[model samples]
Target: MFINVSDESITVNNKWERAELAQIEEISMYPVALIGDVLQRLGMMASVIRHVAGKATFFGTVLPILTWEGDNLAIHRALDDAQPGDVLVINGNGEINRALFGDLLGEVCLARKVAAVVIDGAVRDIQELDAMGLPTYARAVNPAGPSKYGPGQVGFPVACGHIVCNPGDAIFGDRDGIIVIDRRLVSSLAAKLKLQDDVENNFRARVRASLG
Candidate 1:
């Protein structure tokens, strides 16, 4: 059954499902930056969406969130609706003062094995996130916590770094940057990317031979 997070029950839909997104693990092997490069730089999030804490490599289908500045109710709502292989992609409306995510929520993501989190605003607890080895990319860090107010949406398109992200979009992030791909294009694009890699490798080999 499909779990729904109604306007009243994002708090209760917080049940974690057994892993069903195993294919994303295989897709994660593709270099996110290279894929974006090959695609002529489309789907890359804003450069400001950067490494704040945790391991660098991560990729997953997105569960996008939209929240008002200085508020994080949508993020909490998305948490209940997120799957194990889903990256919580947040558009915090560029609010930089109040940190919307932190260690406690990271504990939940860790226990549930959520792939990663990318917030286009702010997050705190950098050291704790690093210690847990979870990949977290955010615009900045702040000590002030946010209000849990409403007027937010979950599982919708939200602009992170000027890039509009829809639910179930493929996303990859590393120290280099974050790249988002349309979910429907993942299969065909991945195949083409593999071919490009082979061609590049052989070209490099020929160059080496000529030099030798």
Candidate 2:
């Protein structure tokens, strides 16, 4: 699912219509657990990836980074190009032999005010990443570093964590797991998620009363 190409400037477009802040905040208020339920058990990323740092909850429009396995130069470009409200949903093709990101990159992302990072591959420096206090999720961690050698793409449609990621799709994550929502679906889904949460809450309250 990955290929190595000579180093060159990636031509993938940088700008895409992102979800609104109001939508993002509303969605973030709901637990991923509830959102997962409302989504009809959809948009879940591969379960192999787990939270390894910072606040367990993170939500933002996806900024996908597609790279050859074990390579990270494109990630640098992504960091440089990322805006404050982006979540870097990276596709390293599930390569685990080399760690594609680590503490150094984590610091840059935090400084840039990025919302979070989700790597569908290996990362390193778990302690430092946690210390930096930014959300990060990855498939695995290794001490081995990545090759900065190029041949990767950024801001493109990519598949990661067993699901397809479109640039600007909304990404939501927490201690429970990660969920992706199509940008166009945000308004509708947010309303549905709230309704579902209310329904579940009422049901749970009723159960408690019956037991009493």
The TM-score between candidate 2 and the true structure equals 0.93
Q: Candidate 1: which stretches are off by over 4 Å? A: 1-23
> Among all windows of ten consecutive residues in candidate 1, which has the lowest summed lDDT?
11-20
What is the per-residue lDDT of model 2 for residues 55-123, given as tens digits with 9 covering 90 to 100?
788899888999888989888877767888899999998998999989888888888898998998999
Best by lDDT: 2
Off by more than 4 A, model 2: 1-9
Task: List, residue by residue over 1-212, the lDDT tens digit for candidate 1.
Answer: 11233445222223222222454555567687668767889999888989988999998888888887877777766766667778888888889999989998898788777889899899999999999888999999998998776568787677998898878878888778998877777766757777777887899999999999
Q: Deviation in angstroms for 69 in model 2?
A: 1.1
